[model samples]
Target chain A: MRKEDMVKLISAEGFEFVIDKDAAMVSQTINNMLTSPGSFAETQHGEVTFPEISTTILEKICKYFYWHLQFASGKETEFPIEPELTLELMMAANYLHT
Target chain B: MMGGICSRKREQLVIENGGCRGVSERFCKIASSKWLGNSFSRPIVDCQPGRGKCPSLMDLCIYKIREDIDKYSSFSILPRDISQQIFNELIHSRCLTDVSLKAFRDCALQDVFLGEYPGVKDSWMDFISSQGSSLLSVDISSSDVTDSGLALLKDCPNLQTFAFNYTDQLSEHGLKHISGLSNLTSLSFKKCDAITAEGMRAFSNLINLEKLDLERCSGIHGGFFHLKGLLKLKSLNIRCCKCVTDLDLKAISGITSLKELQAFSSNITDVGVSYLKGLHNLTMLNLEGCNITNACLESISALVALAVLNLNRCRLNDDGWEKFSGNKNLKVLSLGFSDITDACLVHLKDLTNLESLNLDSCGIGDEGLANLTGLTLLKTLELSDTEVASNGLRHLSGLTNLENLNLSFTLVNDSSLKKLSGLTSLKSLNLDARQITDAGLAALTSLTGLTHLDLFGARISDSGTKCLQYFKNLQSLEICGGGLTDAGVKNIKDLASLTLLNLSQNCNLTDKTLELASGLTALVSLNVSNSCITREGLQYLKPLKNLRSLSLESCKVTASDIKNLQSDALPNLISFRPE
Candidate 1:
């Protein structure tokens, strides 16, 4: 998937994914949610919107989710951020229940 | 020749498009080379014989751009520096096999294989060899590489961590080879039967060696006698080394920094442990299967900071453990397979910070377990294989923060579990191999955060499934050896977080039960083995993306079901067992 297209799609979900895809995919729950269309339905119609998720948090979560998916799929990417940054992402994941 | 190079270059340009282009370009380049001058004027088939109509320019451009941005920038095709960095990253990952391992080994062993490839550029070899000095750890476990491989590694001066499994392959000569790498701080040699006292002494040259293991080295007679050179040694494991006696332990007592020690199945007696009185920094000690008496624990009492101590299968009766209670800082104590009785409970009251206490098969009754309530910080308490009754569980109500409580093979029943409503933090409660009915399981609704609740070998029927629907956080539900059938199994689909659900030994369950669980995509560990599940049931798990560990032990699964699992099919699967 193209990076800009992914950013635009996930921006509608309300998370900011800053880091590369490696760190984001550690939570298997988020990866599966990203792949399937109905996994993250915002409303009753299942239009796939992250209305509850803020854009900043959506961007970070999307970037982290992509990094993790890339890392888990065995595609080459940058190393994970420091352990402290990982804890921050974990907190974000915990807040979103992802 | 010049005309052939340009066409080959154009073919190379196309070859870089994708895997398909590479094969065609190689064939076309070979065909154009042999038919030198006649190819330019010949039919289009001469230049591109098997080529389908050339793809449109736009399609070629799309493929080229996709290849350049995604496939082209792959580490294997990138510049030497970035590819070398990727190679370093692969090695740093600590575990690899097959193709990834071959790539890493090829990149690092460039210097070793350079003699065969004389025409290879010097810059690539230099870039690879420069990393030789930066490696800090080496694992030569279970490999056929011998002393020659060790000799090649003598240049790694900064190497600090090393592990070797099946070290019987190394002789005294091979052990001496590592003495040159003086920066070694940790080393392990598993199954190294050929090592002698002289071989161990050669490692004394490593002044920086702080941790060492010589497990299963039967020939280590008087191997640990020389300890003056090992003044910095802190952690040691000499399990299964029978030759070690009081003399070796006395020598180790002088190393003040030694904190963690394992002497399982050794000849060390009370006299040997008496030397440990001077080592005050000791925090963890395991003396399982040792020939020690009550006097041995007097030395262990001096280790005030001791947090974990294991004395399983030791000669410790009530008296020996009484002397051990003098150590106030103990938090985790294991006395499995010991002669502990009611009298042992009196000494356990002082351990206030105790988090985990294992007294499995200790012949303790209700009165003995009642003394354990004084330990308020306890989280995990194992009383399996004991003769305790329902009254024993009543005393456990005081441990409100307890998360894991195992009561397998006890006399507890439906009335006894009512006492457990107080343990609101309980996440895992095991009642396996008990006579408890659904009435007892119904009492567990208070534990709302339960993730793993095992009721295998119980009398839970379909009605028990109704109470279980409330546990949304349940990840592993083991109802094996129960009366659950296809109808009972359908209730589990509501558990959205279910990763591991074991319904083995349910003879009544059929293919439909497995089909219901197949929709649970979050499942990673599933065991429906030994049931009436046939090939049709096995098909349900084939598309499960996250299924990692699957156990089909004693089931009717066939080899064809195994063939369906592709090598890299379920990318996340770590273990798959089918029978």
Candidate 2:
């Protein structure tokens, strides 16, 4: 993919995950950050940092974004999650409005 | 490394507090300071206060509260905007149960739209009423909230808009609770049977009320007397309230501020319409299905501002057609199903501003259409079930702005369709007549902008399907005649925008038709009821993920075959036949 079509997401532990801008936009919060007319640091740099979300959870959210896109395009599949990660994942989902 | 460790420890402490108010406030300060440090170092990006570039403190608090909602007693400690967003999110995600709704008590939400939400009973009223004087608008339509539940809204004195449409549990006693809401500007109680003339006395105090819709309130006969004090009232809709007679019109005649009056299908006569002559500001008057005669038109002729008039099914004839010549501002006129014939249409020749004219089920023929040739601004013309034939269509060829034309059950045949070929703006054309053959369908190939084409009774054979290739924008196509075969289905399979396709009663269609149509993924409603398709063709519909309604009646496929498909591949299918 072209460099402008991708975005970088930094977790609480300073680990970075570079993903497609379209896939990362599955989160309404991130979509607003990138596209809102009032240009923010994230929109200018094409990178967003979450001080609350951990690295493991951020990676899982990236996977869910791609899975959501595939599912919406008529590909049916189940998204797996560990039982221990359920509460944190749901809290992050609520914050991101996924 | 030290700062990172400190931040993690603080985060753990915030989570351990179970989202208590004091700890969450400290967490917001720490998060904001960290972002401030980052912005100073970057220097190019200014994270200004109140810009909302970064997530606000309230967003984090709400996120924490949503994580464990059962731990908190109420969201009253948070700011009104935060609590309101949380309340709206809970309702939007369908996660707001009666137990979860308690957190929003006294949160001061300005609006609550819980229309048609299931399980909304009287017990939820306490949480809603706790918003108190801050509430502005509420729509609890179709809810089970009773008189006691409505009584709770009396505490919300600042309400400006209230709608309780189809709330059968509300009676005359329930309306008294909201009588003190003088700030109310718009109120609707549509289809509420309990609103009698006695209950409408509560409206006397709503001095600021501007729009009131009491449509289908069966017992509201003498209610207009109570609304005399409402000087700000602008629009009143009492359609289908059979008890409304000439006396109600006499009572409403004093309300000169009325601009729109919709009293269709009421017991009002010509004498009742005579009471409306003083209301010169009236812009829209719908007297459809009333007991009014030609004399009513004489009374309303002074209403020069009357832009829309519906006289369908009234006692109007060829006489007094001269009264309509004065209303030059009339843009929409519905005279369908009336006794007015070709002689009456000559008066409508001067209505050059008319954009939509409904002459359905009238006695208008070729001679009547000749008088309408000057109406070049006409966009929608309904000639369905009339005496209009091929020769009359020549007069309508100049109406290039016509987007909708209905010729269903008329004398329009193949020779008449060539006259419509120049109407390139036609977006919807209905030719549900037995006389329209394949030749007629071929003449309409130039109307490529057509999104809806209904030929339910036309004799469109397999050869006529070739003409449909030009209409790639067709979202709804109905050809219910028995002449369509599997070869015709191939021509329609590439119309990717088709959401509704009905090939029912065509017995020649088989499994090949279903196989060809499997590529139409946008189709939501598909009907092949009387076709020759069998159970083997049901597998071809698996790719249509958006298909919601599927009908396969009188075919070889059984109900079990459709049920299995619905359960496995087509989970979005809601309505299916053979059940």
Candidate 3:
């Protein structure tokens, strides 16, 4: 949720943007819970780690989320900004839902 | 003029917290002593700047009034931000019609959107320029816009949806500008006559475009650019693109992504259609007016995914229908105006999934109804203007899901009513212009969920009114014959939800019929045409505020009666014709 460090992944299709998250904690997949233990919760089980998600896709997804968050928050103001940024942000939102 | 400016600013003032301080200050500046002395109207505020002079008598007269703006400052009115927020919400959510858009554009630059957002003239240029880069959808259909002015959209790299209706106004240049929008996924350029094969080549650049509609753009020629490059394109409509030949269909073999293709009126023949065998994903194909021969069915049969096929007026015969029998996925088959015979229904026996079938004016007879029994999932069946009779309808009762049954013509008698009673799901039953009597309507009591029942041109008299009470969900009842009397119209008051009551050609109806019908507050469409409705009947309709389309045609009313109907707040009146 911190605004500065986050980034977003813009998909090939202009409609969707994705976010990188701790799949074990965010997703209910049991395989993710076992391999990515620390990513799921703050526990003593250090052997298990996050599974299924690769580092490259996660980085792209995280960057996409950050870009969209900035655009959504900046929508209201005295200055009317370009909507092209919003379209990408909207696409990113749709990707995250998937 | 000087004082008018201050009032304009005050009216434009935003409510901050509860005080109207901003408006008051602006008003006071224009109400200075020098200007206040020349004022024709009295001023109420006594406050004066700089001098030690006592408040003037003129100022006391203006501020003394209780209706002054100062009195409204005490209430917790809407905040300036919240009010602007509401205005923004309304602007975006409201459907701006063509007339409203014209009015908005024609307004003085300062007045346009200024009444809501003051001093917006400086930011207006930036607003339009930014729209090009950020906007996702642009609909400039039927406007006085040209291709040269489309540079406004060049910066919009993220544009995905664009709908243009040039009709006869578009030229090749306009299409070239559209081709530059490479990122578009959905594009509709319906009826743009200026578009041709060259304009189509422009679309070759839109590799990512998914849906394209060039419906009725007859000038477009050649199939130089296929959608094979557009790996994601799903729907393509070139309906009535006359110049496009059979060779153009060859390009479709490359587009594996095509799911729905509508080339209804194109010159596609059997040779050209064979190329569609590769389009295994095609679910819906409309070939309504194509000069297709019996040989075209051989190629069309290859599309296993074909579900809905519209071949109206395609000169298809029984042989063509035999080929389609194997298409189990065929659900909606429309063969309207085709020269198909009853023998063709033999081929339809294999299509068990078929639900909605239209054989209107296809010369089908009693033999066709027997083959239709195979379609167990059939819900809506249109047998209008066929050679079948009421006895044949008995076989259709087996269809449990049958909801809408249109037996508009072709010898439907009172006996057919017995067949429909078994159809529990039957809601909309059209027995229009059929030979059904009051006895047939009495059998309709079994259909409790009947909402829209059309017995137009049937032999049902005022006696049939008693049977209608059984239909709990009946909202619209049509009796287009000289049958219903004033008492029959009065009996309709029991049906509380009756919104549309059509008693056209019911010669007995007079001013009393209008009085009886007006009791139904939800009367949306009242058709008293070819009746004896006088000016008094028109006067009675004034209370039915919800009357939208009122047809008093062929009546003895004068032009003065029409003027009265026009004066009423007939908000939904789109068509009004007095007979």
- Per-candidate Cα RMSD to the true structure, in Å, reads 19.0, 16.0, 20.4
Name the 10 consecutive residues with the lowest summed lDDT in model 2 chain B.
Answer: B26-35
Name the fnat for model 2. 0.00
Native interface contact recovery, all models: 0.00, 0.00, 0.00
lDDT of 1 by residue, B1-579 (tens): 111111223443233221122213111212122222232222222211113332221222222232233222222333333334334333333222233333433233221212112222323323333337665666555555566556666666777877765654577777787887788898888668657888887687888989988876777767776555777888888877788888888877778788788887788898988988888888888777789866787788888878888776678778856676777788788776678787887788888888888776687888888898889998877776678788888789999878777776778888889999889998877786558888988988888888877776678888788888878898778776558888888788779888767776777788888778877888766766667777666767666776755666556676546546534355555445552
Here the TM-score of candidate 1's chain B is: 0.78
What DockQ do you compute for every candidate structure? Answer: 0.03, 0.06, 0.02
Question: Model 2's lDDT to the true fold?
Answer: 0.81
| Tens-place lDDT digits, model 3, residues B1-579 | 111111222332221011233213211111111222232122322243222332221222212211132222211133223222222322333322232232222111211121222222222323323444545666555544565555555756778887765445567766676667888999887778766777676687888899988887777767436454888889988887787777788866889889899888788877878888889899999887788866788788888899988777686787765666667898888776678888888887888998888787788987678888878898778777678787787778788788777776668788667887888887777776647878888887888887777776676787777888888677677777678888777667667676667787888888888888766776666677778888877767766665555667778887657666767745444335542
Poorest lDDT segment (10 consecutive residues) of candidate 3 chain B: B106-115
Off by over 4 Å in 3: A1-98, B1-129, B223-228
Which regions of candidate 2 are displaced past 4 Å?
A1-98, B1-95
Classify candidate 1 by CAPRI docking class.
incorrect
For lDDT, candidate 1 versus 3, the one ahead is: 1
Error of 3 at B46 (Å): 44
- Report the number of the highest-TM-score candidate: 2
Tens-digit lDDT track for model 2 on B1-579? 111111223443333222322213211112212222332222322322223233332343344455566665676865566577777656654567888898788999998978777789899889889999999989888999999999998899999999998888988978898899999999999889778888999999999999999988898998889999998999999988899999998988888889999987889999999999988889899988899889888888888898889887798889988877998999889887788889989999999999889887789999999999999999889887789998999999999999888887899889879999999999878887898999998988899999878887789999899999999999778887789999999899999998878788888999999999999998777878888999999999999887766788889999899999989898777667766
lDDT of predicted model 1:
0.63
